[model samples]
Target: MTERTAKAARRARVLDDIDLRLLRALWMDGRARVRVLARDLALADSAVSVRLRRLREQGVLAGVHAEVDPAVLGLTTQALVMIRLSPNTDSRAYEERLRTMRSVLGAVALVGDFDLEVHLACRDMADLERSVTALRDAGAESTHTQLIARTVAGLGQALLTEEEPA
Candidate 1:
């Protein structure tokens, strides 16, 4: 391998305790200020800032976004739709097309009986039905829908331990 590729591989393996702590803090609260993060983690502000920059540069840290309530935003209907495509169909093209659809919030290319799993958000049941029908007409062989009751644990909590630190 080339020198640049070797250096990149080496950098990927270099996460220490402080780096983990910094990631934990940000995962808990993406909106956390650099000063507050430094104080909470007992590190210098500059150190935290530098670490955050490095994380972003390395593509380990993606963009941060605000969590919005679906009900308040008029998106009252949410469903997990599993789609089965016809044999020999290109799943990647179908996934890419579904991602561009307005009602589809997230899409995952899957294995087993279903080719794609899609998360849809809509204003009501009617809208959700329409979106599903559109997907079926577009090329899905069959589809199944399951309503999302609630998120028991969010991403941050799921990734980190629930127990409080001593």
Candidate 2:
């Protein structure tokens, strides 16, 4: 094997306990300032910065994004749609198509009975119906939908550990 390839492999395995601690800190709070993180992790600021830069370069740190509350923005209607596709269908193609629609917030490729699970945000029941109808017209054999009453947890909060820090 090439020496460059072997060196890259070694570098990948060099992450230690400190790196894991830094990652956990970032995961809990993406907006954490580098200085504060360095203090918390009891490492030098430059060291923390180096680790963060390396993590970003290695693609371990994808991108930091903000989390917004949909309910506060008057998006009161949230629906989970279970779509069943035709036999031997290419659901991914349809999934990509659904993503292009404004109401579709997220889509997941599923196994078993349902081919895709879609999450949608709409203004009301009528809008939800319209969105579902469009999906049906686009080749979904059938869909089962349930209105979300509340969102108890979200992606940002869900990433943290269940137990609070002492």
Candidate 3:
């Protein structure tokens, strides 16, 4: 078989039915106990533990993280920033810098008119302006920002309910 075909076959077999269900359960509550997960998945506690370890080892499951409330951090304003940089700028380096910013919740690399989409939680509009200024200094050629009125769903909400890989 060709290399491409073999790679596709390997990707298809990565996750089975039990892995999908376990992923869904963990997505909802990362802190769930092994016993609780075993009960939910109809598996033995030891089996659940083994599956979880395998998932982590395969890099399929990143570490669990707490979803913090921006309000609790005194951040009352939320904005989505669409940024475009000069063709010569390095997007990966800029993304890494964004990780060091206190207001940056997350950032995505885009392929269309925009180069990056950044989610920011700030104390107020003034804080957002500061972030915009920093973006320009960091090599953003142009930026368009919009205030987020509300969030109906979070990232990966749609993908979370899908079945296991074929």
Highest TM-score against the true fold, candidate: 3
Per-residue lDDT tens digits of candidate 3, residues 1-166? 9987876567447878788889888888889999999999999999999999998886677789898889898998999999999777898888888988999999889999999999999999999899888987888999999999988755674454555534
Candidate 3: where are CA atoms >4 Å away?
Answer: 1-12, 154-166
How many clashing pairs does model 3 include?
0
Candidate 1 lands at a TM-score of 0.81
Cα lDDT tens digits, model 1, 28-144, are: 788999999999989899999999999888766767778777778798899999999866567777877786788888888887888888899899999999999988876799999
Cα lDDT tens digits, model 2, 133-166, are 9888788999999998877653554333334446
lDDT of 3: 0.87
Error of 2 at 34 (Å): 1.3
Q: Highest lDDT: which candidate?
A: 3
| Collision count for each candidate, in order | 0, 0, 0
TM-score of each: 0.81, 0.76, 0.85
Q: Which ten residues in a row have the lowest lDDT in candidate 3?
A: 157-166
Q: Which lDDT value does model 1 have at 22? A: 78
